[model samples]
Target: MPTTRNFRTRRRRLSWPLIAGIIMLHLAALYGLARALAPDFTAVVEREVVSAFTVTITAPPDPPPPPDNQPEPDEGAAGDPGRDAVPQPVTGQPPKVRVKRDDPLPRASSTGTANQSGAATAGDGTGAAGSGLGTGSGNTGSGRGGVAVTKPVHISGSIDNARDFPVPPGGRAARRGTQVIVRVIVTPDGRARDCRVYRPSPDPEADRITCQLVESRLGFRPATDANGNPVAAPFYWRQEWF
Candidate 1:
């Protein structure tokens, strides 16, 4: 039998372009299928990605100093009302009015006898004793009075918290001296539940943004009552742009 040589099959490597083309074709087919399933794929709203900035307003510069040599204005003198009036000569004998003389006090007679009954009583214009009001205690009720409920005390709330606001594009209505006052309603769970613009800024959008920012960033512990019970309360804070 003659000897025969066996050769192994050679493996070929794919070119980068061919590989990229295959990948692109596969992606295209997948995209077509996805588009067919859902035509309005892009209609879903997504969270906007934006850069945030903390805004603060700088205090206005101190007013210019007054001139050192400025003359002080003198205050007007107060005039006496009677100074200009001339006294009328005795006003015709002072109008002749009669004054009644008080009569002398009556003297107690020696023949009058003292009260025969010996029961003692006391009264200082208040009332008779035990007539529903002579007791020293404040209230007439025998039971102790109820404690008064004072206003709720705020345990924790950020009044001066620096908040982050998204910087809008093109700087529209983002000028200085703009401020918005927001009222945040804090629940008993120490969370900000609702927010509304208490005082709106010049720009309407600024007022809306103020509420949104407060609802997301602001945190507060509910106001506590005199008995330390947590309650829902509104907290006001201001944000200004500069």
Candidate 2:
């Protein structure tokens, strides 16, 4: 009866490991919450910096030119207003250059006349001895002395009738030797006009009759000038009465 009192004993429901795991889970949750809600400690800064650099360009040197020694022309020498005026700058177009032409030769030296020397150069006659230029010859070849006659007109045989000619009457001694000299003008149209007796025959009737026949019924080949133009020519002739 001295030790008869009953004692109650309880069994463990949860282990110590379980209790420890529960405590670790609670610490991780609290750490995550604190990290999410905590203030940021990182710093941010904004700055503007200007950068500068220097650049250099170099040019090539030009060659030196020769120096001019001639003196400039005097502008005031002539006292011309246009020449003395200041030269205006031309910008729209290029400057114009003037070209000069030389003058022609004078009249004295320009014309060359044919002389003896020129004649020696030209031939005269048909054969070698005669085949040299004659004395002073004109352009028309009338030469120098004499009448300067070109081509003399002849009496036409067809137009001059024998019956129309003068009898040239004279004295018995001078009849056959009687001579008549006359000058006639031949027109450009081949008409013989202005007949005059320069030297009459011994017989006056013969002289008058000769002049009349020449003026009325004579035809001539007109002469030409140096220029080859047909013109009236004065002709002289002498006739001996037969």
RMSD of each: 51.6, 28.5
lDDT of each residue in 162-213, candidate 2, tens digit only: 3545443343456576688989877656677788999987777767777777
- Candidate 1: worst 10 consecutive residues by lDDT? 137-146
Tens digits of per-residue lDDT, candidate 1, 1-242, equal 99999999999999999999999999899778877787676233111222234457899999999878977666896655775678777745667678997754335444435433322344322333332323231222111121223322335433243344444555635546678887776655666656877888777776786777666665665565555555556677788876
Worst 10 residues of 2 by lDDT: 42-51
Off by over 4 Å in 1: 1-174
Error of 2 at 224 (Å): 0.4
Model 1 residue 242 CA deviation (Å) reads 1.7
Candidate 1 local lDDT, residue 78: 66
Could you estimate the TM-score for every candidate? 0.31, 0.34
